[model samples]
Target: MFSPHGPSLRELAVQALSSVERGYDLLAPKFDHTPFRTPRSVLTATTEALAELGPFSKGLDVCCGTGAGMSVLRPRCPELITGVDFSAGMLAQARAAHPDATWVRADVRALPFAGHFDLAVTFGALGHFLPAERPALFAGVYRALRPGGLFAFPLGAPPPPTSVPYWAAVGFDLAMRVRNAVWRPPFVMYYRTTPLAALRDDLAAAGFTTTAPALPALGRRRDGSPRCRLVLARKPADPR
Candidate 1:
């Protein structure tokens, strides 16, 4: 659901018809007004989890839309913080909001940095990439980090099969499939695609040791599992 100041049905329709870059450009001004922006609660939980493993130097935020991940990166990374995304419009909003942090306009699949970051965090942006594309995305993040550096993100538990949220996600992904079938310049976002096990396997294939620690701040699901877990992937340290 969107706020009173958020994009209307007509505006959203037009955005959905455009390419991802152009769509975000159109939505950038009111993105914060919509539910699409990462919630402050989730951000806080992620920050707390990362703080335990950090005291890091340079930090990178992959697919950093509107710079929400910067809140987590700033305190933990004292030396430098950078946010990278392909959307110029999103980068512009991020620049205006956090003028001091470095904003780079680059695609995550081909991140243009090498052993440059000590810590990296991404929030609420994974659904944009399909499962097959994740290899490139994870590989790039691995390549971007310094030896033994980390790449972390908060992942939510899948809703129970009988739950309303589960059905809602199913419906949303179904609608997206239909939309992409009929439309050009498809907007790729699917809620059900990234499962925790698959993602951990992908991280391993990309040469990172991966772990998921339950975020107590977010509480638990009805099934007694943590509502959210922070996936921490660490690139191996170079052999001396």
Candidate 2:
């Protein structure tokens, strides 16, 4: 599902075998050309949803690779926008693309800000975090936002077990488990690790009131359920 400019099979193989940071560094230049990039359809849908909920001041894009989510933040929050990522290569590419915004090199697990933003968005980055690590990530995001601020991201419904995509994801996760079992510097990326229930609990524990809004732009499934939902998490106005 990659474009002509996307990484080759050998390049992907090398990336899969390397550490997450190194793998992303190798993929940074062509990341936007891959299926891995957050699709424009999702971006547009999220922007529309946020428009109804916002008129925010400052926005932050957590793990903002190539700054795709920055466009969504731009319309919702006008004063300032910041994109943060631990990947130097990805941040460099993002900086070149959006010179008007600030780019900070920092890990999402330990975000380096407090009460600095009115809204935060992340795209296609959660899979890189293991289930056990989500609490810390959510906490960091919570700490970065001002009172009554939001941390939003889109999450798709899990693929059916009867589908090819389901088996593919299962196989990919199995392979990653084996790789981590045998390799140094574990590369944590699992498609099925984060579930809605667990995530809701984690967000609540981190002091956010979470809501899942149906992303109508993505349409519905055969069962009439939403294909994707945007997780809108608001940090309580008073943490005390």
Candidate 3:
């Protein structure tokens, strides 16, 4: 699932044993060559979806590795765009790619902003947080957004139990759990933790109304469910 320029098996193995920040730091140079980077098509579809609700001023991307989300945020956010991540190496790459955009190094669970952004988006970074960690993550996003501002991200539907992809995901998560149990500097990434219902409930508790719109460009599953949906959570215009 990696390009010719992607990290070697030795590099990936070493990374898996390192702390999350260190691991990503090592992977940063070759990140775009791996499947781990958000796809351009996904970014384009997200940009189209967010366009319908915005002419936003400032945009923030949480866990913005290598500035993929910055591309999506740029056309929609006329004023300013910022990306935040914990890995200094990743931030370095992002700064180089989108020099004009602000790049901050911060843990997303404690995002350092208050009512600052008109729009926020995160891509493929949720698996890094455990279920217990999601509340704080959502709360930070809520605090970061301006009143009536939006927080949007696309989530893929779980593969069916009978499918090979489904089993692969299970195996990956299982392996991760086993690794974390016996390893130092635990790398926390799990595929099965963030269900739609749980995310909606967390967003609501964080004082945002949530909606999930099918991303048609991503296509549908065999059972006809959307393969992916963009979860749009909006902070209320009037504070309660």
Candidate 4:
């Protein structure tokens, strides 16, 4: 669902036919008006969670599209904030919107900084990365953080088999697979592929101790399970 300011069907069609980067570039101007932007509820919950764990210094927002995550980072880290993304168009919008924060155009997997930030956060970007690519991405985040620093993001509970949302995600993944099979410069975005166990293991292997905290603001499932959780990964104080 999109707001009145969101991209039109033709705009979305053009984006779907383009490469992921180019598609995002075309979509950047209207991205905040779409449901694709991380919800404010999740943002608030994450901001509060970070506040409880922090008073951090510098913060980095990986794949920070339109700078939504930077807003969450600013209060927790008073010193400085930086947003990095591969999309120049997104970075351009972010830079214009939040002139106070530094914006860098760089791939998350090959992030160009080491031990520079006290805190880092990413929102709604992991699904774009395949399971195997997670290690390199997590490692880059690890390298970007200072000793005793943290990297955090919120993840939702998997949709139940009987739910419409579950089938919707499955169908979307299937369609994407077919599209990638036929298209060049594949646009990789799959919601059902990444799991919590695999993600935690990858973060751990990348040398960060991890934890998942339930976000009460998102409410709970029928089984009394948290509907969403904030994943916090810490780069240890002693690197060795």
In order of appearance, the predictions have TM-scores of 0.98, 0.98, 0.98, 0.98
Considering only N, C-alpha and C atoms within 3 Å, which residue pairs clash in candidate 3?
A: none
For candidate 2, the per-residue lDDT at 119 reads 97
Tell me the lDDT of candidate 2: 0.93
- Per-residue lDDT tens digits for candidate 3, residues 41-77, read 8999999988889879999999999999988999999
Best by lDDT: 3
Q: Write the per-residue lDDT of candidate 2 for residues 1-240, one digit (tens) a residue.
A: 989999999999888888888888889999999999999999999999999887799999999999999889998899999999988889989999999999999889999999999999999888899888898999999999999999999999998889999999999999999999998778888998878888899999999999998999999989899999999999988877
**lDDT for each residue of candidate 4 in 200-239, tens digit (9 for 90 to 100):** 9999999999999899988999999999999999999998
Tell me the alpha-carbon RMSD of every candidate.
Answer: 1.1, 0.8, 0.7, 0.8
Clashes of each: 0, 0, 0, 0
Model 3 spans with C-alpha error above 4 angstroms:
none
- Please give me the total number of clashing residue pairs in predicted model 4: 0
Clashing residue pairs in candidate 1 are: none
- Residue 87, candidate 3: C-alpha displacement in angstroms: 0.3
Alpha-carbon shift of residue 58 in model 2 (angstroms): 0.5
